[model samples]
Target: MRQALERRRAAKAAQHLPHADLADVLAPSAVPEAPVREKGRRERPEPIPSRRGVAKPFSGRAPRIPNLPAFRSSTGQVQGLYPWLYGKSLPPVGAYMGVDCLTGGAFSCHPVEWLHRGLTSNPNLLITGVPGSGKSATIKGLALRLLTYGVKTFVLGDIKNEYAKVARALGVEPVELGPGLPTRLNPLDSGPLGQHLPTDPIELRDRLAEIHRRRITLLSSLLEVRLDRKLDPTEEAALAYAIKDISGEHDGNSQLVDPTIPDVWAVLRDPHPVMVEELRADSVKELRERIRPAADALGNMVQGSLSGLFDGPTTVRLDFNAPIQTVNLERMKGRGDETVAMTLACASNWGQTAIDDPNGPVRLVIRDELWRAMRIPAMVRKLDADLRLSRSNGTIEVLSTHRLSDFEAVGAAGSEEVAIAKGLISSCDVRICLAQDTAPLAMTRDAIGLTDTECQHIASWTGQHKGRGIWKIGRSSSHVVQMMLTPIEQELTWTNERMSL
Candidate 1:
């Protein structure tokens, strides 16, 4: 009966199961019939089509794959692949200048440091922009910040008295020059050195020679501006002799004898007896005649409209120890361009003397509206020399002007004035350019050697990017930046003269 039961069960099982092929039945484990799943247990769910088809969820942590090797790359290549990851920062050891729009990093620049690092060959800066482009504001901001770090500033030719408030804020007075102002600056003031007198006989001789040369150059520039013509060769020679004779009279004294305009005028009017005797009659007559025009031109400065400011001994002195000193020419406004030019020439000469000390504090000499002064060939030449010698004197010259054409406008094409103007531009190793008009933009590009990218940036600048500028130092690529100013800086540098309008 048991055997009959087993046979029945086996027959039922065989009937229920499907027939298998010999190959499947012989396979290891025989494709073990899918194990019966537990009741109420979940089966694998169907994947819903993702909106972004086939994309996996991005996790903050990267998933690891078995047997995968690591990958390596260069920072530069990676930065190229992801542009926003690049950041080029300058040395962080200077006053905060602004923000580098490219990398969004703070941009700091110290002209002295740049010189040491060889990033800039010279410590001179040229700031160019159209009017209302915030060039002045940028310089003012830089000056105020530098003062906090003990850098002295000498603002020569404050055409609009823009730095007057700044000077006062720094606890120094601006030397105001005009028709009725009490302040007077003798372009010939020797400052603390008294015409740079030295104890050594040879040194004194050299110093005297230098002073005489500068005096002649300054007088020539003044007379040229007054006469509106370049001095002839004979006129220049006669003036040189006159300056030499007058300086000889002051040679014996160790104390600085301030040479006044009247003294120089006297020598020019009547050739010194010694000078006259040294020359033949015809030569004397010719010398006197040649110097007359120059003398008369100087006479205008001493006795004419320009009399009070430069005629006498310096009534005001440059306080070298003071944090700031400004030659305020605001009062000279409406007096005609000639008057302004002469005043600027004299003021700049006086400033040069003031900062001549080798042991003096490092200076930041700012020439705002620089074109007004640099238009004069002699002045521009002196400026170029100053820029070249700035390194020795621990000085940095910052020149700001409205347009590059200002240099071209100094004289006729191919004239010395133009050459001098170009020289001044070339002396600067650091250039800060702001918004410009169409014509100026093109001219600046040519003058400053701007690339196509830089040209586009300058051309597109507008009201919305008022304080933005391009800084090109040495041969490096240009940096686009927005001048960053503190609230106090903005208040001090506010130059929107039309804001009241």
Candidate 2:
């Protein structure tokens, strides 16, 4: 046992020996030798001394913490409680919007770019806020910034000429349409579609039919806006007959010669015998009676409040190659909301046809004061159709209004028009909502599915600075983006110049 203890002590002492001394210490010799130290080499230090003069081992545990998987949440969910926890929700593509208040990173986005990236379902956008909450400024700044990327901006109906200055800055003149303006827009004008026709007979036939349907829909919408009600079955039939007769009279072999509003009005005024018999009318008088309301409404456009504008062929064609185009409807302000609504509807249809090319470059179509057009159910339907087609045409249509409740104002409570108008908001995947009064924001919150925190942010922004809004991307991503504008853009988007003066 004494020899075994001596060997164990030798093994422990050998651990502290130098390489040469290890062999000496392990060797079986009668005399024991101490560990040999190298010259100028310090010995190993002892364990850290304790205050009690006794070294204490590290007995503390790493606290029993459990590993957690990363949780995904929107800005609305986190209220930015954890900033910089995630990378950018969107890629750095398209226009430079501004700094992301949540991440302190620059936020840049465009509807078309996001759509191509599969970050958004559709390219359309819906902007809603109070009148002075920088809705127009956001649109103008983004539109101008997008010019660098070859995205064209077209204001379908600039009700207050808000985009006129932007167009001028882009070296393009806005088309002003109102009383005393020589500009005319034919609702039936075949736009880019007629300019380029398919060579195949089957394709050509389908295209022509599509054009016919569009024209009919436009005319029907105009009449409904004037009459203030949906057309009856007999009235719709009579109107369809009148449109067909006008088309047959002016249609060319290889091209569709669009019939003017006046031509359709004339046909309705004097019904052809075939039309009379097709409608089972006893005589032309009976057929005229069936279409008198529609005819009178059309007559108003040619001779009443809406005269000289849509009565003939389009005097000015839309230049799609231009960086920006705007239809100025400022003069229509005092003509009553109905006249303005009807006129805007026609102008919207005209502008749409001009940009409806499937192969055309990506265009940003802005519809300002969309609530006015929504007043007419037919116009609401037209907007719904546009939303559906935006995906195929690759057009990012920005629809701006004052409040979400404005959609409810389109028709009576629970009416089909109201449902369709609300559905329009649903079809848009990207919604930029600015500060709004708390009362209206309640409806907006429920309609947009905004989280409670997001709702508070938007409501509180009313007293905050301009251009501070919540940009909701897709279903989950929400960003508090402050839309920054350059000095030049500031001048272009400044709309309160008159008020400030």
Best by lDDT: 2
lDDT of 2 by residue, 421-500 (tens): 98998899999999888788888888888878788778677545699988989887889888898899989888887888
Q: Candidate 1's C-alpha lDDT?
A: 0.79
Worst 10 residues of 1 by lDDT: 57-66
lDDT of each: 0.79, 0.84
Q: Determine which window of 10 residues in candidate 2 has minimal summed lDDT.
A: 54-63
Which candidate number would show the highest TM-score if scored against the true structure? 2
What would the per-residue lDDT of candidate 1 be over residues 1-501, giving only the tens digit for each residue? 999999999999987767777777777554559889999999988776454344456623334335769878987578667865534677787789999988888888788888899888898999998888889888888888887778888988898878988888878878888877777777876664554467898887777777777787888887887778889876776676665555454347565456777887887788865666554335656768867888888887788757778877777756678989888788787887767777888888988887888678889999887777865777878887889998987889999989888898878899877887888777898899999988878789878889787788889888878789988877664688899888877878887766776
Pairs of residues at least 3 apart in sequence or in different chains that clash in candidate 2: none
Model 1 / residue 470 / CA error / Å: 0.7
